[model samples]
Target: MLKKQRILTASALIAVSLMFGSCKSDYEKLKASNDVAKKYREAVKYYNKKDYNKALDLFDDLTQRYRGKAEAEDLFYYYAYTNYKLKDYTSAGYHFKNFAENYPSSTRAEECRYMAAYCSYLDSPNYQLDQTNSSKAIEQLQLFINLYPKSERVADASKLIQNLRNKLEEKSYADARLYYDIGDYLSAVMAFNNSLRDYPDTKYAEEMEFMMIKAQYLYARNSLYYKQEDRYNQAISYADQFTEKYPNSKYLREAASYRKISDQGIKQAKVLVAEASVDSKVAKKLAKKDTTTGQPQSVVGKQNERSPQNQ
Candidate 1:
């Protein structure tokens, strides 16, 4: 029985290999044939069967031969789709865009145009990669909307734009958070503030605002006494903004505590500034007396030291 089972499996494998080999043999023969019509026929068959690689090879061969002919419309349309189905999105995008531009009045033109831009959307990488493709996708999608305001795809395009925008926002948030995690408090404060400015309507707005104030508080706490007063004041201002916008925020209590600490920082900084100013004024006054008396301060100090009725 085991010997019989092995024979059956071997037979199945041989049949499968023969089928694939015959398909390859037919494709190679058609490729070498000078008949564009036969090639087109076989390309359609391959496309219908979802054999996109074979379809792509044949379509690529036929594009030049069929150009400017009546058959070019359907041929070019399928050619672009062949590339798309092959997952060569960059080439697909270009070819699809070209088809729409070349066949402006075709019923398929609008669909191809939308697909071209959608391909770019599909090509956009995740947030961890460079954002060049994401930005490009946004541009392409927006242009599609402007060109085809009545297109049924416009709503889906808008949703895709927002989704891509959210990804960019996440990258920005992560960059700011990284600074905070690395103990770069001042940079974190600036980055979080910039993020909020760039994406005011972001879903991360509340969290960003909360982090910004927290970053500012840390920045103020670490700053030199002379710089702390202004930084602490900024932290307080951010906290106020957060409270006003999201009074019911889950982070409200923590944010309030950060604000309180910032207030105390400002008070301490103010005291230091006052003491510094008083010391500066006293030093200047003594210097002015020495200058008016036409004596060096060191000489005056020595004279005072000697004259002390000690003799």
Candidate 2:
């Protein structure tokens, strides 16, 4: 009885294997066939089943075959979406843009254009990395808004652009802060200024302003005595500007402290410079007197000349 049951189980397993093999062979045969409609239908079925890889393959094959035909527009649309589904954003972005450009009159043109920009947005890296994609996303999104002023997607596009801009702002702020962290005060000051200039309304404005003041003060503190007065004065000026611009800012007290320190530094530097100037002048006067008097006679020579033995 056990041997008979084992034989039955073996037969069932073989039947299942054969059925699976036949199904796989059928798909392979369909792929090799030249039946355009059948291939397109199967691609759509695969797409609906969330089999994106298989759908992508079929769409890739059918794209050129349907070119310039009525089905081409829909085919390209599916192809772009397929790439998007596969997380191939770069290719998706290109195909989406191509579809919009090729079919400007299509109702889906605006959507595709927006998707192209969104793809670029999605491709944007972290704020700590390169921001080229963020810039590109902003440009694309802005263009989309300009081209379709009445588009319902305009609001969303605008928001996306703002988000990208914020990312860029963060990158700028981080880069400037890096200079500060590394004790490059002068570079930090310049970088902070640039960040503010580029993004006047940045959320980091308050922190950046405060850091700029501190950086300038440190830069002045590290300067040579001759340059200290001017650099410290500059720091004081920056502090004053910060105070005036953000009177109620949380950094107000710290900024005021920096200003006070800078003022003290300027005064000390001026005094030292004056003392140095006086000392230099006195030294010059003594050197001149020595030069005018010629070489002095040694005391031993004078004593020897006065002694009777020398006489």
Q: Judged by TM-score, which candidate is best?
A: 2
Q: Write the residue-wise lDDT of candidate 1 on 266-289 in tens digits.
A: 776677666768898744533332
lDDT of 2 at 2: 100
Could you tell me every candidate's TM-score relative to the true structure? 0.76, 0.85
lDDT of each: 0.81, 0.84
* Worst 10-residue lDDT window, candidate 1: 290-299
lDDT of 1 at 186: 76
Writing each residue's lDDT as its tens digit, candidate 2 over 203-239 gives 8988998888777766766556667778878878888
Candidate 2 weakest lDDT stretch, 10 residues: 290-299
Compared with the true structure, model 1 gives a TM-score of 0.76
Top of the candidates by lDDT: 2
Listed per model in order, the count of residue pairs whose N, CA or C atoms clash below 3 Å is 0, 0
Local lDDT at 278 for model 1? 80
